[model samples]
Target: MASSSSSTKTDPSAQGQAATQQRLTEAWVRLAKQLTSSKDYQDIASLVAKTDVLALKNEKLERELQDALTAETRNLNAIQEVKNENMAMEDACRQKESQVEAAQMKESQAQSQLQKAQEEVAVLKQELDSNASKITETVNSKLEKEVQIRRLTEEMEKMAESFRQTEADLKKTNQANMGQLKMAVDATTEELNTLKALATPLKPQADKRIPSLEAIEHDV
Candidate 1:
């Protein structure tokens, strides 16, 4: 009976030690799992926030580059337009210079023609003055010749009237003395015949000296 009572006491002590070791190991495992899960969640949150900030910075840089390219295209077009306008202006200036030269040539030709016309007019005036002077001299010579001709005509008329009176008186005296002086009357007849012969020649000489009124009018 003593041996059976000792074995029962030892079994009770071994059972109590094994139960305390199992409880301590389960508590340690629960603490280690909670610590590892919290560390993984913190790392994921930090990486997502950094990616959003980088995307916003990239979009701003792209907009600025497009604005600069559009401005450069507009400036190139404006420079080309200015160059075309300058070329047109140069062509117009050359055309104007050519027109001015043609006008000056026409003016010079007109001036030369005017000077020639003036010289011709001066020559004509001199010829007209010379003709007028000659006409005046001819008129003075004609007047002097007319005065001399009139004086000669009046002298010849007076001489003819005196000869007619003398012939009438001689004829009356011959008729009264014819009976008493027959010989003398015959002698007087012969002398009268001779005088008639002389008078006939004198008539032709008088006709040659006188000019007709018609001939003088025609010469004037």
Candidate 2:
């Protein structure tokens, strides 16, 4: 009876060790996900069909990786767009610089033409002034010639009036001497024949004065 009672007491210790082993098995199965429970075994078809926890978690990870790849692609595209805009702006600046160079060349040509035109105007003005001075000198010479002609004509007319007055005084003195000579000739009529013979010498000198007007005008 003592050995049998001792075995019964030892059986309670064995039961306690068995209970601890059962809890360790359950904790290991829960941590490592072993398909141990009969209910877990039966639920496999339902879990796989509904996309159980493992597959759902893998799908979420894959989705996050794909979104990260898409964001990287967008950043690269923005950098390329900025590079293209900078190239366009540089091309526009080159075209503006070319246009400014062309404008400067045209301005230089205009300035040269203006300087040539100014030189031509100055030459023309000098020629005009020279011609005006020549014309003034010619007019002054013509005026002096006209004044000299008027003075010469007045002197000629005064000399002709002095000659006319001298000729009229000589004609009156000759007529008075002829009247005294005729009265003396009548008082000596008896001696007139002999006196007339002496007067015959004066007859040739008187006949010389009675020359024709045509002969007198020809002598003058």
How do all models score by TM-score? 0.37, 0.39
Model 2 misplaced stretches (Cα beyond 4 Å)? 1-72, 145-220
Q: Candidate 2 on 49-161: residue-level lDDT in tens?
A: 57767688878878987888788789889888888888888888888888888888888898898888889888888887888788676655445433433343343334333
Model 1 residue runs over 4 Å out of place are 1-82, 138-220
RMSD of each: 20.4, 23.4
lDDT of 1: 0.54
* C-alpha RMSD between model 2 and the true structure: 23.4
lDDT of 2 at 16: 91
Instruction: Give the Cα-based TM-score of candidate 1 against the true structure.
Output: 0.37
Q: In model 2, what are the clashing residue pairs, if there are any?
A: none
The residue pairs in collision within model 1 are none
| Window of ten residues with lowest summed lDDT in model 2 | 204-213
